[model samples]
Target: MPSSWTVLAVITVLTIYFCKNKRYRWFYIFAKTFRRDFRGFIVYVKTAITARLAKIRNETVVSVFESLVKKHPEKAAFLFEDETWTYAELNKFCNKIARYFRNEGYQKGDCIALMLENRPEYVGIWLGLSKIGVVTALINTNLTNDPLVHSVLAGKCKTIIFGSLYANVVKNVAKDLGFKSFYQFHESTTKEDFEVLPEFIDLRSKLSNISGDILSSRERVLADIQDPLLYIYTSGTTGLPKAAVVTSIRYMFAARGMTFVLRLKSNDVLYTPLPLYHSAGGMLGAGQAVLSGITVALRKKFSASNYWKDCAKYNCTVAQYIGEICRYILVAHNNVEPVKHPVRAILGNGLRPQLWKQFTEKFKIKEVYELYGATEGIANMINLDNQVGAVGFIPWHARWAYPVSLVKCNENTGEPLRDENGHCMECGINEPGLLIGKINQKKSIFAFQGYADQKATEKKILHNVFHDGDSYFNSGDVLVNDEYGYFYFRDRTGDTFRWKGENVSTAEVEAVISNLTQLSDTVVFGVEIPNSEGRAGMAAIVDAHNSLDLHLLSNSIKNNLPSYAVPMFIRVMNSVPLTGTFKLKKIELQADGYDINKVNDKIYFYDTKLKGYAELTKDIYEKIGNGTMNL
Candidate 1:
């Protein structure tokens, strides 16, 4: 061989020659393949490694609260009818309430149920309990006896704090329930006679006796970052609502994700009209306020007509919304000048892709942080960095990554098919798949509090598939991951039914129907239409005693839903069936499919020609079945 320098010179000359020739360049590329793979691996490794580093600690919220109290004591924390609470006053009040709970045989980890409306006291009680490490289970105030009772009992709450407005409902249910203590906030809309318990104590009187010293002492009882903070109930596709144990770690993640992802600041004020019982209102909205030390303007219930006015009044920089809320707001008359408020951003879940651009442009919202997360599911997606209509990507991790698989769904049974390997293969980019959260024992962060039924909880969990001895949380939601790895929501798996070559979610359709205030309640489902390839969209609605404004109702749905998704048949009912927990019972409605001859209830059909829905006469029903009168 030649000298070593000669060999090096020869190699360099060969490399340069190869680089210049396109065909020979392949050899050079082949030689650098390992380096390319190594560089890509480094990027993947870095993203996976630094994923959880930016997560906020649970104590950060309370620390921020303390800072706000010191920096801006007189700033309003909450405003309600004839009442306003300053940050300092609210913090002190919450501390005192927490102390009272601690002194009254309550300890960290104990569950306390809160059944109150959107009021100042509700905030105080929730914040106070959170400070003391008490897991507060929020009961839906609209839920009647059995569901109301089941939720409280399911959460295993020993004590309950309820608004006096729900005293009658609570009293009827409490006698059978084994709650240790009951504290009633002295605020009620009803003056009707109701039984008052002798043991029941007024919240105001208890707070009066607790001095500022007690409040300060109680602040020392700070909870660890991983401790349980909330137990929120989510109604699954089937069964009663199950309580999902929300840890401080998850709450912190939510707070940090909302702040950095949505770019919320201390100066930004958020308008939230969603119920506090829901995760969007509690963790996403209220949690953001606590962590960012931002002001939250609360509304008891959503009112499309009043939504813009409230945003202007509160000088809201951002607003929280759900899919249904957005649809309702869109249906309202378009404003002459959309950029009316100081609002710059809107954040929430389930906003449809079709309505995404319209909502942003019409409302003058600069950004839409369409986040995706179940109340209990560990995996979360935030549209950080202003990626519209797409849930942001999750960094790769062996344990925490959400691998989506397009399951082979059976046409007859409507269930997914499994392979011999048991583990489902991931779908190609842009294809919808059932999103499953990978569970690793070391990194698994969530636990389902579950409903009263343990079997119900077990059914939701899938174990031992990907790794010989691993488990994963079944989110029950279908999602699509694009080439960029950003996820887009498809539909809830079990809730969506095939109809006319398209999948229809009753939740999505009901969202459109529920916007009409004329209906007391609405349930949408798929009913088998004669000669149809799949189920046809149908709606059962509890109309007001007076006749329904069919013209207005049809117009609302047409404006909101696509032609294929809109209910072809509308059945008017005296009442819509619901579970004890206020969840719409669709099973009974689905079973009771439309039959004009057998059904006593009046049915109507959407008359595309009439530009409105009309009564379903026997002749019309037959014509629809015969395809003579198209829906």
Candidate 2:
């Protein structure tokens, strides 16, 4: 047996070795994260108890903002470009807007549509509307023509407040939208075809007479927590966007929850480039700041080239992101090389498992708080253990409080599979299935505030999902929970399909392809093969400068993915467009298929004999169509 000194020496050596190894480092982080989360949980319990004891009612976000304003009057509330607004300044600005809305005869429960870019004004408008107990419909700025009109109408918004940036687009839909009033901000073009309204500057100029008092202001209304605050539109994959109801309670929970998750302080500066319309940006980024008395640096758009510079400029301790933003930064030569930045933690979703370590080490970030939740979904998962690729954990100890369960789902139909007894089958550990959250109104924590459209809301709820009388909100996302109770998001049900009698996850394939530095952007979808029984994997790639090496790419993909999982077809283009929230626009790509004549971009397919991609010519297409080629 070794001596005590020798044993200590051996333990020290092993510890040093494990610390250097990337795989073993997470154990330390997980330990620290676990402790921090436990402390935060205790704080949350105390806060909840205090709120319950106080009988907090008719409490709006404005009340919370006002409280924060009192605490940190001189602190920077918003930092946009070269401008900065203090807490008191922002409060007074919101008060003026609230007064103006009241003067315009806007009442409680009235819906107002706002189509603006990521700016201080956007946040101001949202807060101003909320202060007056009015629900603001945050319309996606990318929407044009019919989709724009449809989103506003779907929310039942009588008034539209748009930015001058979308003047032409809004003008096109103004006449058909039938909005009772229209307002624009900054350089709007007037059209005689429709009823055009004055700019926000004019309204602000007229509202100088309004009082800025918080408690005594007549414009301020005491709104119940259950009352609607925002009508956030969802990404319209199948049809026009549906407005999701976001209650004051849900918004407050998100703000407080994120603050707890990040362990944020009043001094923490959050830098966010994501659009304000998205929940990740609205609630977690700026919203968290509003509740915590922290400063936020809001960027107009995400620029990979300037990301590091912006973070350094703002002295941001926390940054917000989606996967595409990280991928873009990693691909950019300047960003791939290390640069000085103050960002310590990044909070958002869609960080790929493969790029997790690379992103952290390259950027020198401490935490990557990946979260999984829809704008209106009842279920929300946050990764507290710094677990790579996991959206959240469902520890056996706490699973009772968070009643989220995964049920078996058919990959082909994209629906939850019901057992013979008419009960939804719950998936075992490590099994990918549809995730559902129990909706109990009495509990409040598990409550679901669904889409504004009643039919759409009804479509998302799975009645008697597991039991005969219980209700569950269908997440429409497939996830796999491990034996440790850590849940990993697999893919959206609609994005996964059956191929070669196996389920192919588009996200999994995309993660593999995204490993290539040359491919700036990529979208994966299942395309129908003429002679095949099921759909074949296809990738629409954005390769600027067309510098992708086919042989090297084929080998990398082959090593990363299974034979059937490998995308059989590749479409290289100058650009691959993304939606407003930075999600891939795959509907058009799926419709276009692999038709060479229909698409302007170059198309290629795996040539087994050549062991690389080859030009997809008409002759090759004919051979594949007739089952002469074995793919």
Candidate 3:
């Protein structure tokens, strides 16, 4: 038995020893993150954990939303420009949607595609449809023509509810589609401002004529946690958009995790300008309002110039972003005085380390909850300690609790490296490898609801991970974790390449180029160039119709994609050479690179100074190669 003073001395010595070395900082980070998440965890538990954990196990997005609406009926739910809607008002509107759809005979498991832009009504339509168990396929508003037609048809949607703004575009494709009905939603009461296409049913007037009361017992039973709720489209590596099935439990997980990890307050007004069709805006952004009773301010679309101004106008305390959104706002809104802005915190991913420090310092951001996850992938991580460039982390002492790992894999192809015993090898500290998460049915956080396509879903699963019989979700992302357990996103699978600090999916770019070229064959691939951090995009198109207009193509590319996504170079050919299997000979084209001396095709460079695609001259090509030309 030692003296009290001696015991205290020993405890102090042990504490100091454990907190020693710079490499042993995981203990501090774990404590900090745990303390920060404590409140959210308690609240989540008090709210009955999740739809999966509830007593009835019948918990769902609709039921949880109903609970929040009942609890905070008078609270402001959404603010869009000059309009504001209380939780009660929003709920009533959603009820009308449910009633209308039910009365019209839309049954459980029915699908309706929504092609509306970001608006309060957009949220209402999806929420309401979910009440009667109809899966809403959130179509990207930026898509046009063939790609738009593919997105709608992929979901097997018999009906499509589009905004009045997209009336003409929808009308052009209406004949091609097999939709039973086309419902049009007017953005304003003065619908005369926009043409009401004769083919579209007046959804606004129809909803106005229905009852806004709660659903009748005889109407329909809402969805279960395991049931499909929404279909969110993710750019597929194969081609076209893949409809990812977002189950009710999956939605609950995203919303609850965001609210908890962000430590959102009831008074927090979130300003989200990201498109609503994506999960970042649809599930996480809108979920904050629907699940937690927080006020959300909607933006029609992202305007970098108006980023902070909107925050100040909406009295927003929090903001949301994704991809190059932070970079866009940082560069475009450099004149914005951060001191006067009401935003104190930001939530998003895709902010590079160099840009992270600059953006936070310039904007006076106090907290940035940077996150890493996928729409269909199971692995999810968040940066709670504001670790620069780190997507998220799992402490070394608690990796068992996380069920995620970075396994050694082929750097280019992303195939997991295996040992002689047929077991996957885990990457060591600072070594980049494929990030994977174990699929456990009992753990809802690690549960992968997967995409709507059975083949697509099966393609993402990697088996025999660690044991003889084990499985993991293939994230298709290469990540490096340091000794402190901070995970940094390095790169993605070979098909996807990083450009301007953003992942550019070749398949998606090719899809856009193919459509823009009047259904001509296209091969989009990333080409490495001197004085570049990542690969630069180069697209090769087959001008089958010989109607390719360089100026029009340049303008369309700008409108369709982000600055980083646009290809820097273009090659025009009579036909794209194919491999033995009838696939585009990407290997041959990629090996050819962008060297003017090596390829016989007519090449053109996207010259920013000239503001259009210019035929590649020998001198100009040399300038690009020598780093004199800034892509």
Candidate that scores best on TM-score: 3
Report lDDT per candidate.
0.68, 0.77, 0.82
Pick the lDDT winner.
3
Question: How much lDDT does candidate 2 score?
Answer: 0.77
lDDT of 3 by residue, 1-631 (tens): 9999999999998888876875356666667667544543454454336544742567788888889888989888999989899989998999999999988889899899999989898989999998888989999886766667888988888799999888987887898896778899988878567767777789998988998988887875656778888999876456667899898878878887788777788889998998889888988998899888889999998898888889989999989987468867776766755546788788888877878888888888998888898888778888876888889877676677667999999764678899999989998989999999999866666777788788888888889989978889998888999876788998767577767644567887887777777755888888887745568899988887678998999998876665777899999888888978898887688778778899888899888898889999999989988967778
How many clashing pairs per prediction, in order? 1, 0, 0
Across 1-631, the per-residue lDDT of candidate 1 in tens digits comes to 7999999999999888876845474555446444433443454344333234423333534555677678888877775544667787788788888788877868877889998887666767877887676888988776655557777888888978887777777777777676756888766433353434567877766777886443565345666655667778766654345677676656655665566555567778888887888788887777765655778888877888888888888888889887657866876745445547888888887676767888787776777777777777755566654566776554222123344333444332234456788765556657776777654434424434433357766776777646567665676777777544567776555655545333465766775677664464888777766534456788998875856777888887765555667788888888777889997777777777778777788888878888777888998888877856645
Ranking by lDDT: 3, 2, 1
Clashing pairs in 1: 147-580
Q: Number of clashing pairs, model 3?
A: 0
Worst 10 residues of 1 by lDDT: 395-404
Error of 1 at 343 (Å): 0.7
